[model samples]
Target: MSGSGACEGLPGAVRVVAGVSGSPGSLTALRRAAREAARRGGELWPVIAWELPGGEFHAARSSVPPPLRERCEQLAREELLDVLDTMFGAAGPGVPLHALIARGRPGQALVQIADRDTDVLVLGAGHRGRLHRLLSPSVSHYCLTHATCPVLAVPPSPLEAHLATVCRRNSWHLRLDAGQLTEREKPRGRVRDA
Candidate 1:
């Protein structure tokens, strides 16, 4: 369903492309993209890409086991739907959310889709650890450099949220996206900066 439009009634114009891989970071990005689409009355295109091994692409379809490919496709669909369900419950957003599945490298897939049809490309700020950052380049980094549209990178939770994770261990309820930072849970007399 790369180009398939799951939701209708949206104008055929601008689109918000989000790189979703079902990771916690990607899910956070998806929520931000959905809210942006809802606010701007644009289409939310959540894209997930899968790829065959390097040696398998040139092989004929008959050469690959049918069941394996079928299972891969099924899992891809299920994961995409599950992410959607998890993000927004029974009643989805007012804006149209069209989930898309592309076939290629993740970063390349997102760049291709955005170049073709996207107003903004949004992704989560991936692993910031020294080893990971030094060893591997993230999809967000690739998109920031290559994507035609503007890229919005949402960083992971701040220190307060991290402390909450360690101290209270409560489930995440609020997300900080591209919006004002309201004093929702801050203790009295604690001054917070944006």
Candidate 2:
């Protein structure tokens, strides 16, 4: 669908802004954002946010070399392109696509881009464990509280949840039962011959 016509929000055009990080959940969010944009007859804006090794405060304290900063931005840009290519391929999403590489926290960047009241901010509702949440702030929570526009936090896909269970099992050194494996595979029609 052509987004040539103006949308209600954002003065001229309605924007469906999504946060991408190359993660499976983020990929799901990206796909959902595209659909949202198409449904609203708006543009899709996928933003990848990045920061220096030690974040903005550290960079300000130390004289970060220009090359290093440039490299960080370049990597973020490449990741954004890779995600877009993976999702839509050469055909591109039906609506207009505008990719952004922002230099800040993911939540803050997304909230800033989707500033208008009518704009929609899409994010992955990451399935983070307690330790992970302690180490890093929850982007979805940040956006939900701070965003001026509506925030759509997509839940983790079933596959992602299954993968996380497998990882946890592996980390705990738990042996998988052969019968359980077959039982799980049977439902998916991938059972193996004995």
Candidate 3:
């Protein structure tokens, strides 16, 4: 198994918590996930986890400006919703779509929310070699490992398929580094924007 979190759960109607990073992989994955959500009439939960420079560098700075943090969170929420609209707006109108932005680790935040009712978690694989530490880090790896439900690792456009490849290629390295790994190696299939 991949170096994902230690917990695992059940699978059902495919309620998905798809991470949105606005990258090609993320976009493609989002479209596929949205369409599936539409098909199953399940909730498509979109999440964005972003950390500011202060949070990255000045971790001890409790005096971080409220507005700055708020703005970043707002932007995260907006960007996720926007991506969903731009990719699958047709099915998005009250399509049970929900967008959220967290202030800390993306993977952890996404997992916490998805753990409630999420049956399937979706995320675009990262580029090859980039999955290596300090390079193309993916919180999806964490979700894939920890969530009790079945995880859906969607492949992106051919131009974007490298993420998953690289993720798998770097799986050993990640595990050595204590990075979380997912259960299955490959996803089911690719979903186009509809």
Q: Evaluated with TM-score, which candidate comes out highest? A: 2
Task: Sort every candidate by TM-score, greatest first.
Answer: 2, 1, 3
Q: 83 in model 3: Cα distance from truth in Å?
A: 1.0
TM-score result, candidate 2: 0.84
The digit string of per-residue lDDT tens for model 2 on 1-194 reads 11212223335678998899999999999999999999999989888889999999899999999999899988888888889899999999999877788888888878877889778999999789899999999999999999999999999898897677777888999986656543643365577889
Candidate 2: pairs in clash: none
Q: What lDDT is obtained when candidate 1 is compared to the true structure?
A: 0.73
lDDT of 1 by residue, 13-51 (tens): 568888889877888889898888877778888988776
Poorest stretch of ten by lDDT in candidate 3: 1-10
Number of the top-ranking candidate, with lDDT as the measure:
2
Error of 1 at 81 (Å): 0.6
In angstroms, the error of model 2 at 152 is: 0.5
lDDT of each: 0.73, 0.84, 0.67
The TM-score values for the models, in the order shown, are 0.71, 0.84, 0.65
Candidate 3's C-alpha runs over 4 A off are: 1-14, 90-94, 130-132, 161-194
Tell me which of candidates 1 and 2 scores higher on lDDT: 2
In order of listing, the candidates' clash counts read 0, 0, 11
